[model samples]
Target: MDLDAYVAAHAFEWQRLEALTKKRRLTGAEADELVERYQQVATHLSVVRTSAPDPSLVAHLSSLLSRARNRAAGGRTGTWRGVQLFFTDRFPAALYRLRWWWITTLVVNVVVTGVMIWWLLDHPLVEQSLLSPAEVDQLVNHDFEDYYSEYAASHFAAQVWVNNAWVAALCLALGILGFPIVYLLFTNMANVAILGSIMIRHDHGAHFWGLLLPHGLLELTAVFVAAGVGLKLFWSWVEPGELTRSQSIAREGRTAGTVALGLVAVLFVSGVIEAFVTPSGLPTWARVGIGILAEAVFFAYVFVLGRQAFHRGQTGDVDASLLEDRVATQA
Candidate 1:
């Protein structure tokens, strides 16, 4: 094929396709003509690639065909539809699909924390090593309870939210490293265990539980979810099953991203509880009850909505059409 002669013949059709694509509205005849032009230009591109193989011409035709294709396919989805789809399908399904990872993380961490607290209670020397006698007294007598009300509730809520969100984000970001996620979880649980031991030994066990449970229940759950998702991302590549390692990592990474974004809201709720409810004059049972309620609601959200979304084939990833096009290859 003579490249110059071919370009001369199809240039008009390409220009017409570009023009029709740029139109804001089209009459019936013009719409029909646009489709006709689009087909011609696509064919022109294919022939150029196969016969002439001019990079510049092929590139121009490729760009033109892309725009024409989007126009024919009705362009992008509406903003409301995208947002609704995210909450209804993407976020929840991701939670449900990765339930085991986070759930196991939550259980194991809780057990580790319990063991640490029990060990510290039995071994008094550990507390003295971690904190001086005066520091332990200060924390047990005043610091532990006062920490919640030290700042205005609203100010403190924002602060807690930002801090916890950063932790969750870090877990997700460092999850591929494997060790970092384990280190983060360990440090977090250790802090709680250390504090619990000091408080319980000082006869402030109920007080500690009162202040912690209201917010800790949901807050810790969010962190566990992040760690679990991160671990899943690490394992995705390690044991990719049938998919290629890259494919597995990419799939789990997207799910991790969804979990990360969703946890922001979860942490915010927990922050509110920690700031307001934890320090409130309500009975400990009531405060803990509210925390339990929030935690229950979250699990229900995952099991109910997430499970439903998963059953429908939702993998917490972006729409297939929106993902970049891929070319198949053989090993």
Candidate 2:
């Protein structure tokens, strides 16, 4: 393939790309020249990859191309348009791409919650071990029902949103450790299970489902999504596919951040449902129906808009200009 001869022929152009990459400030003409040489060197890298395929040369050109791509795209900008693009495109697309992770998380949580409920129901000892007879009675009768009305609707809604948002955030922040996510999910599911068991044991099974399903569907789903995305982020470092571990973690972590932010909106909706609809005078059917409708819309958003964005090559990562120029560790 005459690798050395080919390298010599185009060495000047490659050198120019390197020079432009390292230059702190570039003139307009030099900027144009940088782009030109970048493209030419990209072709050169392609030729070398196909003709000679030297590991060292390929890595060098790969890093150079990455830097050039970022430079040509320009650096990051903080503007309203960029903010608008992020929500409309990047956020949903990330959710769509990692839809499976969250969905699996939801399913597992539901199953775990159900199992906990079943175990408690079958074994009265477990329920009694967790709560006293009077305490359980109070929860099933007054405490559970009064919990909604005791707080002002607005305050309750805000509190619910904040609390659930915190849980989601914890999942993201601690997801890298793996154990924290599992512990958080287990603890959450167990609490719900205990409450459901208490209600059902006292012959208020219908009431339990009625209140829980009204907002619990979407609310729980958001939490699951958070945990799922967090787990995926951890897995990115565990098994990064073609990318280096650092590169994979960086990409997935950014995407996970998007999910964390998007989930705030989602949890807010669920909080509204829990505060207003669950305890309102609305008929059971209507209340549960609203919850179902909200959940459906979320699924549709992820599947429809998210799918389209993903197919168009959206990866939920920040724009290229906002990312590393050469997968280099930089601030």
Best by TM-score: 1
For model 1, state the Cα shift of residue 268 in Å.
1.4
Q: Tell me the deviation in Å of residue 79 in model 1.
A: 1.6
Q: Which parts of model 1 have CA positions greater than 4 angstroms off?
A: 1-52, 61-78, 327-331
Q: Global lDDT of each model?
A: 0.88, 0.85
Backbone atom clashes (below 3 Å) for every candidate: 0, 0
lDDT of 1 by residue, 144-235 (tens): 88999999999999999999999999999999989999999999999999999898888889999988999999999999999999999999
lDDT of 2 by residue, 1-331 (tens): 8888887888888888988888877788988888678767767777777778999999988888888777766522345766676767788899999989989999988998899899899999888788888898788888887887789999999999999999999999887877899999999999899889889988999888888898999998999989999899889888999999998998888998988888898999999999999999998899889989999999998888888889999979877644533332211
Return the clash pairs for model 1, or none. Answer: none
Q: Which ten residues in a row have the lowest lDDT in candidate 2?
A: 322-331
